[model samples]
Target: MASSPLGRPTRGTTGTNRLRRNDRWIAASAAFRRADDPLVVDLGYGASGVTAFELTARLRRTRADAEVRGLEIDPVRVATADAQLAEVRAGRTPFPRDLRVSFARGGFEVPLADGRRPAVIRAMNVLRQYDEEDVAAAWRTMATRLAPDGLLVEGTCDEIGRVASWVDVRPDGSPLRFTISLRLAGLEHPSIVAERLPKALIHRNVPGERIHALLTDLDREWDRAASLSTFGATQRFLATVSALREQGWPVLGGRTRWRLGELTLPWEAVAPVAGP
Candidate 1:
């Protein structure tokens, strides 16, 4: 709508509760809790708008006034989401009749006619199609459209939503942290998430890359903590994460999050290798 969509159309693959992990993370983030304005953008919410609806529902747990605007570059996809909204309005669906959500056609520009910047923007699985080098520019465009103190969450996840990782960027487009989340049940190794790294770090998973080392270490530590498995995968993961921090990985959060099979570290810990 704004000259161009800023990126190509996606396969629009989406499923019920596919983004539940992402939504829960947002609900718990300080950005959502302390938003001067509780407006959020779900950029590139694919073939279905269910994720957007789900996001608003989850965020409202922390901020009752939370609102989510689902932006899609494809007009047809936008129309589909809008149609679903209509169904809810007409009482044909179980979605809350007063749900705070909307669908629109736009891209990295985030064409919200109201001209108000959102407090949080979630761009999940939106940048995986672009060349690795193109990620920064896209991040800059979206980050510029944020409210002061706003947050941009960019990342990817497995098809079934079991494994996920994301980078948290500030309004100035500077990345702050990297987070990896897993379901932990039957999880063979943390490295399995190597395939779902954010676009900027996906190709950087080569032998000498920081991300590669991080995952490699995690796998080894996970094995070392296998003895804790008698307690549960949850205990094993917690021990593995503790080993990472003790080894100076700059791990963030604590057992509360680690017990959930989530690990967060400063961006510097896994940023791509500089230069070609």
Candidate 2:
């Protein structure tokens, strides 16, 4: 991999399957499923490379040749991941022998060798440390390293991966959609997703803002569908999302995805606007 100045190191907190929700979403996305070149980047995959390994395993379900390159700005973390890679390669791990994954030192610049631009770059929880104003520029840097039709999935999630949300951005740095993925088993309300919103929308979740309005509406609908909770959280969420659509909330995805506690909306629907 090409070298670049290492960015500031993060706390690098990570765990196995901590990013399963994000991984599943990427597996279902057209950008990932239809990529002629299935190259994915696990940007800033924290102190451990387990998430990257899980991402590769999940993605391989759809594309056997899927390639996942975990990038970390911390050389120590990179070395750790490289050691894991060595173990996997030597048949000392459970990973497939032909697993196409690697670890390298890089940051928002994504310094890949041979000018390789990935089809998907999942930068989860990496931007929380930066100022909100710096998010756009960081996004632009990553977007510029993508293929023509590539995507940049950036956002945050809880440690155990119960509540998750992310923005799907194009190579030009324009967000296409925002999706919230929840565990739903004990979900109180969909508004809880506000806590895990992408930096672009987290601060925007306030009175009179589009994101706030969306969450408020979701919570209201979720409560309205409380009667369906007797059936199950899945049914309740389905009803709530259905109500959102009926109320003109522009909910995306079908029951198949809704069953997984996911709700997506066009970015324009919740994109931050000027003012509170």
Candidate 3:
């Protein structure tokens, strides 16, 4: 008999467009845009498979051949998503009848047939319930399933797509970068993302931690840029991120991405310092 899916059931708290920000990130990522196969996996897609459908639709804008496979450890969730996919195929749902999407029972193990490997595996909110100590092994298990040069995006977000953060892990199971994406409108502080950080860094947001310092410095710059608010939140955020880069934060991307309320830095920027 096949081995059981290697994960616990998700809390199943899913909503429409909850992962829109993440989808946009993946659509633009090199792993998906440059992949020869363009196969993406939406691991632990919670109660609804809508995320997978939405991801495929968004990615199709960039790569028409992009495909998404929604995986869930709970067999019930898989069945539910499959049913929803049938509706899409019958043209009863708003999604494209030919939406390149499928549903399967899986978890961190990411079982796939035909020796297929995904260009990107998005595991949002899947590890929030796991212990911090369990993060590395989980990342390794999932990352090993990726195609060469593939990416493993693991992170957490709120119910809405407004606040999100993810870590880009290489196929070798090592983190490459950390990114935070937030809605800039009426934003209180950039550190608001601390609440939704990936499991690996969530507990590390304490004093003396690199992540804590990053958030602290980010909040400070946001306040300093408050004078630019009259220009608009996007402009204010642009200034904030620019300041961070000036202070040698190793911020990645340029104004085009900063305009979208995104900030990416090498994982070392906020990686947890080794423990005693």
lDDT of 1 by residue, 10-125 (tens): 77989888888889888888887888888999999999999998898788878889999999999999999999999978888767878899998899988877679998999999
Using TM-score, give the best candidate's number: 3
Which ten-residue region of model 3 has the weakest summed lDDT?
1-10
Displacement of residue 96 (Cα, Å) in model 3 is 0.5
Model 3, residue 111: what's the lDDT?
A: 88
C-alpha RMSD of each candidate structure in angstroms: 1.3, 1.6, 1.4
93-171, model 3: which lDDT tens digit per residue? 9899999899888888898889899999999999999998889999999999999989999999999889999999999
Model 1 earns a TM-score of: 0.97
The TM-score values for the models, in the order shown, are 0.97, 0.96, 0.98
lDDT over C-alpha atoms for residue 185 of model 3: 99
Task: Rank candidates, lDDT, best first.
Answer: 3, 1, 2
Query: Between candidates 2 and 3, which one is better according to TM-score?
Result: 3
Assess the local accuracy of residue 230 in candidate 3 as a C-alpha lDDT between 0 and 100: 92
Highest lDDT scorer: 3
Q: In model 2, what lDDT does residue 123 have?
A: 95
